[model samples]
Target chain A: MQFSGDILIEDEFLRDGLQNEERIFTLAEKLEFLAALEAAGLRRIQVGSFVHPKWVPQMADTDALCEAMPRNEGVTYTALVLNGAGLDRALAVGLGHLSISISASETHSRKNTNRSVDEGRAAITPVIERALSEGVTVRAGIQSALGCGFEGRIDPARVIAIAREFAALGVQEINIADTAGLANPVQVFDLCRKLQDAIGPDVALSLHLHDTRGLGLANMLAGLQAGVRIFDAAMGGLGGCPFVPEATGNVATEDLAFACEEMGLATGIDWQKLRAPVARAEALLGRALPARQSHVPSPPWLREVA
Target chain B: MQFSGDILIEDEFLRDGLQNEERIFTLAEKLEFLAALEAAGLRRIQVGSFVHPKWVPQMADTDALCEAMPRNEGVTYTALVLNGAGLDRALAVGLGHLSISISASETHSRKNTNRSVDEGRAAITPVIERALSEGVTVRAGIQSALGCGFEGRIDPARVIAIAREFAALGVQEINIADTAGLANPVQVFDLCRKLQDAIGPDVALSLHLHDTRGLGLANMLAGLQAGVRIFDAAMGGLGGCPFVPEATGNVATEDLAFACEEMGLATGIDWQKLRAPVARAEALLGRALPARQSHVPSPPWLREVA
Candidate 1:
C-alpha cells in the first residue's frame, strides 16, 4: 500500500484521444478543450500529434492548435512526434515539450510507424538529440510494451531494452504503454518493477493505458503500487484503438482523478470541473462517453463529502 | 498482494441485469441466457426475483422462469426475495436458494422498500427462519453498505451490525453491496476488512457491486486483495439502479471474468463462452452492452498466452 503522495496525470485527450477519432475538430474547438483542461488544473497536456494528415486526419491541426493555444507559465504543453519530420513540425511551432514513441512489438511497430522495431530504435537517437538541442522536454514511449493486437504477446526484454536506450539518451521520462490494452495488474506490477530497476532512478516513469479490456484503472492502481507516479489519460475515454473498434480509448481523466482522490493521492485536478468538457465532447460526438463521472449526476450530498 | 486462489462470481444478469431495462424479455429468452450461463461454467447464478410484477414488470414471468429453467446438478441457481410474500412465492416454486436484502441507509430503505432501516432489519429474522425451516440456503445482503444514492455516505458500523444480525440468523452467506457505486478501493479495502472481522470466517462473505461509478472492476480487485471471493455481476453490465437511470448496473460478468483470468485467478468459468449470451442480451435490449470481452475478438494468441 506504500505509494507516492502525489501523482501527475497528463491529459492526452487531444493527442491519443483524438488521434483515431473520425470526427475532426477545428482549431477553435481544440483550443477550447485546451483551455478547459488548463482551467481544470492539469499541469501537463499532450495537445496533438505531428503525424501525416492523410493517415490521421483527426490530428491534422496540430500546428494550428500549438500556435493558438494559451501559454501558461506553469502548464507544460507537449505534442506526439513520431519521427524527424514530426520533431521538425513541433520545433517550428515553438512547442517546448515533445513525446516520441516506438512500438515494442515488431508487427505493431511496422503497422503503426512503417518501421521495424530495430529501425524505430535506431531512428530515436537523432530525434531525441535534435529535440534536446532545442531545449524541449522529451518523453520516449514504448508502445505495445505489454501486448499487441497484431503481434500478440510482446517480450518484456524488448521493453526493458527500449527503456535502457531512452535512459542512455538522457530523456526526461520513459512511458510504458499498453498499446493494445491487453495488460493485467500482475503484468503491470511485474513489468513496472523490472523497468524501474532497469531504467534506474534518474529517469521518471509513466504509463499510458488503454481501457480495451476494462483494466485501465486497475492497471493504474498496480502502477502506483509499483512506484509509478505519472499517468496518461483521455478526457472522456475518447480515442479507441482503431485496430480494435470495440476497445475504449485511454482511461477517462475524470474517472482516474476521482479514483486517485478517493485513494488519498494528490492529483491537483478538479474532478468536478472536468464534467463541462466531457459533456461538450459527448454532445459533439452525439453519443454517451464511457466515463463514469459523465453519467453520474452531481447530487447535493457530494458537495459536502466529495 | 495476497488474495484468494479462486474467486466465485455469481451471474446476476437475469435479476439485477434486466430489472432496469426498458425492454421486457420473454421467459424463453431468460431460459436461453440461463443455459448459456450454465454452459459458461458459472457455478452460481441469480435467475430472477419474486417481487411484485406490478412493481417490476420486467421480471413478471419469474414464476414461469423458475418452473422451467434447466436443472444442472453442478450449478447453483438462486433468486432474490424482498419480503415474506416473495419468500413464500420462492418456497412455493421449490427454489432451494434464496437471497434476502435490506438497505443499510434509512433514506434508501424508505425509498426502495418503504421501510425504515430498523424495520427492514426487524423483517429479516422471520424470513430467514422460514427459509431455513424449508431447508433453503439463504443469503442475507445489506444494501448501501458502502454508500447510498439518497443519503450519500453510509456508516460501516451499520453494515457490521447488519452482518451480526445475519450471523445470528445463521445465514449461509452475507452480501455487502455498494448500492450507489460510490465506493473507492481504499473504502472497499477498509470496509471489507472490517466486515470480515465482524462477521468472522464461518459465514461466507460476498459483494454485490454496481458499476455506477466505473470503479466496478477496480473495487473487485480491492475486494480480492481484502479476501472477498464471491461477487455479483450482471451480463453486459445490465441493470442500473432504476432511480439513477445513468448509473450502470452490476459489473459486466465477462469483463470481470476476463480480468480475473488475466490475473491468474481461477474463476472456472469459460470466458469465451459468455459472448453468445452477451450478444443475445444486446440484441434483445437493442443496444450495445458494456461487457469488454464481448467486443474483443478471440485471437489465436489468446489461446497460447491469455
Candidate 2:
C-alpha cells in the first residue's frame, strides 16, 4: 500500500466547477483563471466543456477560451465532449486534448445524456477514433461508475467492461467518477484494484470524486493505495453534483494536494499557491466555499517551513 | 482490506460539541438530547465533561446532566476527566465511564492544560488507578497524537509511551485523538497500526478525530483499514478546536455512520435517526452546522432500503 510516485491532478474547476455555478464568468475572467492555474504549476487543466449554451450557459464561451488561452509546451489542456455535436465543437475550436464522457449506469445515462448506455457507448466510438487520428490525446471517462442516485450501486463488471472498450480504442486514460458520491474506502479500493487489473497497466486510471458524503479525500486515499495516479479536482470545491444539490461536487484541488503532500506523495504544485485562486473564486461567486484548508490562514509553523 | 464486523462510535456531541460552541444548552435541553441519542441506538455516549465551569462554562451543568439522564441497561455513558479534581467530580456524580486525556505534544500540553507532557503523564497516573480501583471503566486518551498546532508534528514514540503507561495502568481502552486536526491518512494509518501493535489488542484502540482539514473521514477510513474500531464523533459537526477557530472539531456522527454503513460496516445506529438530534442542536444554537448528511434529506432510494 505504498504510494511510490508523484500523482497528476487534472484541474476541472473551469469545466465541472463552473458548470453548476450560477455566476458565469466572462471569457476574459475564465482565461485569467486559466493562466493563474497554469502559473500555480498545474500540468493538466480541463479548460471547458463543448456543451450547448442553452443547456449550460456557463460553458458557452468554450470556443472563445480555447482560442484565447496561450498553449504551454508541457501542459495538457482538455475539454469534455458528451456527444457528436460537442465533439464537433471541440474539433472546430482546435482542442488538442479531449475527453469523451458517458455514464456507466444505464439509468443515469438515459437521464443525463438522453441515451441508453449502449447508444452512448456506440456514439463515442467514432469520437475516440477521430480524436486519435487527429493526433489528439483522448481520455474516456465513465460517470457514475461506482454508484448512481437513480440506479443505486453500479456493478463493477459493467464499469470494467466500459473501460475495456475505451482501452481497446486506444484512449490515453480511463476515468471512474463517483458522480453520486456513494463510494466508501473499501468500495473504492476494491473497484480501483479490479479496474487496474482489467486494464493491465497499459491505460492510465483516473478517479473523479465528490465530497457529498464527506468521503472524497478518504476515497482518494484508497485510490492511492490501489496505485491510481491521476485525479480530477475542482478549486475551492466549486462544483456540486447537479443531481444532489447539497452535495459538494469535485474534491477541492488545494485540499487534495495538501493531503497528498502530507502523505509523502509528490504533487509538483505548491499547496499554498492554491489559496489565491480559491479566494478569487469565492469572491467571484460571492460566497464562502466548503474547502477547509483554503479558508484557513497558514499557521506560523507551516508558513515558516514553506 | 475487508471490514467485516461492526464498529463502535462514541457520541461526543454533548460534551466536545458544546464545549466549543459559543451557545450553551440548558440542563433540560442536554437531557432531552441524551434521551434522543439513546433512542437513536448509540451504545456509547459521552454526556458531559468534569471540567471547571469557570474555564469552560458550556460544561458547567455536567453534574446536573449526569444526575438527570436515565441510564439504559446496555448503554455505557462516559464523561471526560482531565485531572484528579475532574475524576472526583465524576465519582461524586456517579459517572460509570471516564476518559483521562492529555496532550501527546509538549507544547500543546503546556498551552491546554498548563503542564508539560511529562507532568501531564505523571498527573494522570493516580487518576487512572483511582478510577480502576473504584470499578470505573477508564479510557486513557492522548490528545494531539497525530500532530499539533503549537508543535507541528508529534513523535510516534511519544504517543506510544503514553499508551504504554495507560495500558500498564489497566485502562479499559486507549484513544488517540487528532486534537488539532493536523493528521493525514498516512499519519493516521501509521499511528493506529503502531498503537494497536504496542497495546497488543488487550486494550481496545479508539480514535477521536476532528475534520479541521477536511481529512476527518479520510483519517477514519485509514484507521479502519488499520483495524481500529471505536471512534469519537460529534453530532451536527458542532465543535471546532479551541486552539484553531477555523478547525472543525469532531467528525459529524451522522456522516461517519453513513460512511461506515456505505462501506458495509454496521454502526448499530441508523443513519436516518440522526437528523432529529442534529436539528435540535442547530435550533438551540440558532445556526446551521457543518454536518453534510444531516442536511441532506434522504432520497427515496436510501429511505426504502434502510
What DockQ does every candidate get? 0.51, 0.64
Alpha-carbon RMSD, candidate 2: 1.5
Error of 1 at A33 (Å): 1.1
lDDT of 2 at B261: 80
Highest TM-score model number: 2
- Per-residue CA lDDT of candidate 2, range A117-168, in tens? 9999998898888888888889999998987777677889989999998999
Query: Which residue pairs clash in candidate 2?
Result: none
Highest-scoring model, DockQ: 2
Q: How much is B287 displaced in model 2, in angstroms?
A: 2.0
Cα lDDT tens digits for candidate 1, A13-85: 9988877778888889899999999989899999999998888888888998888888899899999998999
Error of 1 at A86 (Å): 1.7
RMSD of each: 2.2, 1.5
TM-score (chain A) of candidate 2? Answer: 0.96
- Cα lDDT tens digits for candidate 1, B1-306: 434388899999998888888888899888989989988889999988898888888878888899998778978889998899999889988999889998898977887789999999898789988898899999998888887777677888888998998988899899988877888878888888888898889899998887777788888888888888999988787877665444477888888888887788899988788887788788777888887777876543665533
- State the C-alpha lDDT per candidate: 0.85, 0.85
